[model samples]
Target: METKLTPGGIVWKIFKIIIYSLMVFFSITFVGIFVWVLINSFKTAPDFMQNALGLPEIKWDYQNYFDIFKFEYKNNNLFQMLGNTLIMIAINVICTISFPVMAGYVFGRMEFKGRAKFEAFLYVLMTIPVIGGASAQLKFLSALHLYDSYLGIFILSSGAFGSGMLILTSLFRGLPSAYAEAAYMDGAGEFTVFFKIYYPQAIPLLSINVITSIIAVWNDYMTAYIFLPTHPTIALGLQQLQRTADVHGSDYPLMFAGIILTMLPVFIVFSFIAKNIFNSKDIGALK
Candidate 1:
């Protein structure tokens, strides 16, 4: 049967079209800028200055990419920075995912006293901006001798009470309770039910958190700069590189090369796992 569009439906369709148009416009602009940077990365100093937005000459300089990896600081290179980032990300993933999943499962499924009060506390913590806690965090890290340490960052990031925890809790709440009941009837314990049943269902959300967390940590400069001045993530290192470029502005290609390298790992990781992250229904597709 054919149905006529209501006036409200027409207005909503117009609104969606306008929004989609804007998204496409901005996306194109972003791609254009990225392409410009990539082109400049291969251009010579004279060619870049003369034709900043133009394509590269017949000769493309591939050395900038190589030189960026060779960037040295106290015997550390790009490879060491990669290692440090992976290590921090590994600890962060374990701590963030494990605690949140457990906490979410408990809050969403289990009946316990003071649950309302605990949730209120989490809401308060979530509403409080992190900037307000900077000084106290510094003091706490100092007291524990965790300043300039990956373990310190891990501890800070592994909180069970946050927006992510709340989101996971809500997701778990929305899931059917029949699965849990069936598992329990089969003699499955709380841990077994959560791990084998609930956790698999939550994998999609978990993947989203993992990607966002990795990107956040990868691009964060201020936190690492304040707490771990000795340890330089890619963002901090890029900032240092840009500062050096201020002295030698002509070597802009090198800086652009570094920028590309900085984005590479994130691109690779997302390309591999993006389907799993976004597809909430397609469980175990990758495996």
Candidate 2:
């Protein structure tokens, strides 16, 4: 049945159409990019150039996967590169999760004379780019004889010196104070109150932070490039592959394979934690 549309109804219908159009545009763009990457990961250079926008005519080439682990154009071994990348990411994730949880709790719940000033200091520090401090960090590491070592990379990555702490602090503050107060009234120590009460309430936010930090460190190239240039991680290895493409020219399939491999662990981890990220009630109150 056709009903007469008022001016307001017509405007509303137009607005809905605009919104739907935008949504469809973005969705198609995202899917197209993803499919392109997936297809390119299996195609040789010639095939890719010929059928850049088409589906794979042949089965997905497993040779790309094999080459990522075994092929060597430069001195770097792909297996070692993968290991180093995993190790760096692990160290970063561990430090990012553990330190921020404790620091956030302290900043959020604990009382101190210079607490406001301390938080202000962190906020200010976050403004300074990591690259800006690289030279100083190198000098300090050189002084301690930690240069070119895994420990050096770990320390540099772990320094929870940014928005992570602040985000956790806000989440902690949003938590109910009644639990801590009750624990305190029951003669529980500060440590006990934090561990037994507040910490539990912060798991969801903590998981979100961990996932973000993991992805950042995993996908990072610049810091790893500058700090451990000789020691090639997966990101660095991918960069090397791209750089040497003139000599090995048009190895898009292998390069894409390396990228997919690099992203696999992060995808797996995110899939596990994604549910928690979307549902705050499972972890604790952010509001």
Best by lDDT: 1
lDDT agreement with native, every candidate: 0.81, 0.78
Instruction: Tell me the TM-score of model 1.
Output: 0.86
Local lDDT at 69 for model 2: 81
For 1-287, candidate 1 gives per-residue lDDT tens digits of 98899999999999999999999999999998878888888877777777787787657888888888888754568888777677777877887789988998899888899998988887787787766687898899999999889889888878887667777888888899898899899999988998899999988778888887787788888876888777777788888888888888877888888888788778887887787666654233221
The lowest-lDDT stretch of 10 consecutive residues in candidate 2 is 278-287
**Candidate 1 global lDDT:** 0.81
Cα deviation in Å at residue 163, candidate 1?
Answer: 1.3
Residue pair clashes in candidate 1: none
lDDT of 2 by residue, 1-287 (tens): 99999999999999999999999999999877766787788886678767877776565677788877875533669877777777887887788768878888889878899999988887777777657677899998899988878899888766654566676787787788887788788999988988888887777677677787778877888877877766777777777787776576778778878777777788898898787777755344322
Rate residue 238 of model 2 by lDDT.
Answer: 79
